[model samples]
Target: MVSERSSKEFFAVTLRVWRQAGPSASGRFVDYPATNVSPDMSFLELLDVVNDGLTVKDEEPIAFAHDCREGICGTCSCTINGKPHGPGHGIATCQLYMRSFKDGDTIIVEPFRARAFPLVKDLVTDRSAFDRIQQAGGFISVRTGAAPDANSIPVPKDDADLAMDAATCIGCGACVAACKNASAMLFVAAKVSHLGLMPQGQPERDKRVLAMVQAMDEAGFGNCTNQYECSAVCPKLITHDFIARMNRDYVKALFKAKFKPVSSASGGAG
Candidate 1:
């Protein structure tokens, strides 16, 4: 159903890709020339063209993970030229286009590197640590009978706006990749702040902070070095301001947990 005449404008580029046989296998960078690549094609599409050539040569195709290329799903994670989600600002890997690079230029691609994210294969790293963190009180447990009418509850405009901003995180692990210490604080802060801002989240706010922070630490994630690289590389443009908010809440929670009022009866018995 397709013809060469229908092809869009084409250019050439060299893809220097990381190749790993498996999680336990050694990895290295392999170069492949992608010729006649359409300028309008996305970076993933360019890889497909290179893969087609590899298939014809009976060679192993590059293994990468992607779903919902429109950028909502965070599965399309790749470190292009040492940057998470390629070189684009506030965009994910799927949003990267071939036109961003000059013709005949070489693009280096690799998987996100972090102690918490283990390599699955070429350009694929296991990000299940995020799931575990989320499971540890990232949500509210409320029994509100029905979906409340819009604006039913009076919420402060500033709080609502901040909540909405924090809610945009797609959990792509870009923050972790960008941080020198490989901290997950940005991601955790976003999750906590988004929920803590709303009325429905107030009930579990203290518990949520304590559990999620503990879970993140137990997952082998590094500490926040305050370098702010996490915010710089975030596709959602999530600010590091949320991390400060989380720190304040976490300290309060710790203090609340440490001190408790003594019961008169218990004190008399002691």
Candidate 2:
């Protein structure tokens, strides 16, 4: 049921945004009043309005990240009122609207906090760590030749569906922000499973998981403690089950690597 009060044309709210001059500099929250805010305005639009006001007054505008404003890019990452992507379910920050709040409400906005995602500026953090992890092994190698037909490979319906679900992760780093231990397992699991579930990924399955996991730990991300907060705040609503699947695959890979037989030059087991 829609509330009548939330449908009003415009309202006002206070934005308490964290302002940091640099990664090493001290930071604090500064309050800015947003007046006559339309209920239809997206959260990023609200920031733009506040920035316009600051520009008119010759003051520095708040720093934040945004792109494609349609919730697909996942570039507009921020914690609104202590919730990733703000007061919404299965939507990114760019999808959040001013109507979610009441007039005169105080909204606390901050950047995603995690050691792996270093602070770049106010409301923006360095997420290149994700790129690094992906580069470690999130791919399959195929010989260069004529493109294979779409139906050349037969994939089970269930596996294809699950692969697509895992592929929906936009690498936003929200999982790390939402986790109490700041873990990145959810993101890694999604990457691993989306490819691991497919026949094309079998050749490098064991190597991929091993390399990515090592890279994740090398990047200083914490391990998952099974709290499941990562899935709760996910904009795509990806289930935590992927994490378990990855764990099983990892164990199997380790066992296979340890016990695989070694053939002798004489064509007999060593």
Candidate 3:
């Protein structure tokens, strides 16, 4: 039997953290008490306070990644209390406020887990998996010459408008985390659509989409089921229309390659 006075004297916050010492090690959730918290602190700052407490006690501090804490860099990514990139919708964990939570909240902090994002350390995973996909041809090859005049090629307003929306992706893996299948379709499509829509990208647009999509599959990412969850949590609001655009470009490339009978006879399938 607990008294009301006892409850008033004690306010406890439970935190379950996914702790792993190294890449090969098995991880488990370690509980810690969130004490002396002020509701005004940002979620990452609260974690910093908890880490400070641990350091004071000669304990190992939680190893999480953060830089340019202003939230523009997307370096500080964490799934908080079961939500990818934290409690506030369409924002990173660093932007989430402790005030949005209650006095005695059960906060669960974990890294974005997927086969592609192997755990590198406690609360940090290797996100370079995304870089590999990008390197596989997410960009246009620059010509070693002066820039073409902007007015030389006029793009339709509707196409240009949609391309801008797709180009805003920050390359954050929030889309992957939000997807049930851990798909990187949203990320790949955004890059593909952004480049493919521009006139300068025409020279290598077909090859770019094929290469990036191949790389995405090789990275062990799942297929997009068109759930639209990727767009829902995207900070930049990148659209699924980009994914459709990528698909169309890929199909057009296939048809173009197949119908070129002389080249098709001389060369193996790409």
For this target, which candidate reaches the highest lDDT against the unseen true structure? 2
With candidate 1 superimposed using the best TM-score fit, by how many Å does residue 237's alpha carbon deviate from the native?
0.2
Instruction: Name model 3 segments beyond 4 Å from true.
Output: 1-12, 145-157, 261-270
Off by over 4 Å in 2: 1-8, 263-270
lDDT of 3 by residue, 61-80 (tens): 99887877766787887878
Q: RMSD, each candidate, Å? A: 4.4, 2.8, 6.1
Order of quality (lDDT)? 2, 1, 3
Give the per-residue lDDT digits (tens) of candidate 2, residues 1-270: 344555557899999999998999999999999999988888899999999999999998998989988878879889999888888999999988888888899999999999999998899999999999999999999989999999899999999999999999998888999999889999999999999999999999999998899999999999899999999999999999999999999999989988989766786565
Per-residue lDDT tens digits for candidate 1, residues 6-89, read: 347677889999999999999999999988877678899888878889999999999888899998988888999999998889
Name the candidate that leads on TM-score. Answer: 2
Tell me the TM-score of each prediction against the true structure: 0.91, 0.95, 0.87
Comparing 1 and 3 by lDDT, which wins? 1
lDDT of 1: 0.91
Better of 1 and 3 by TM-score: 1
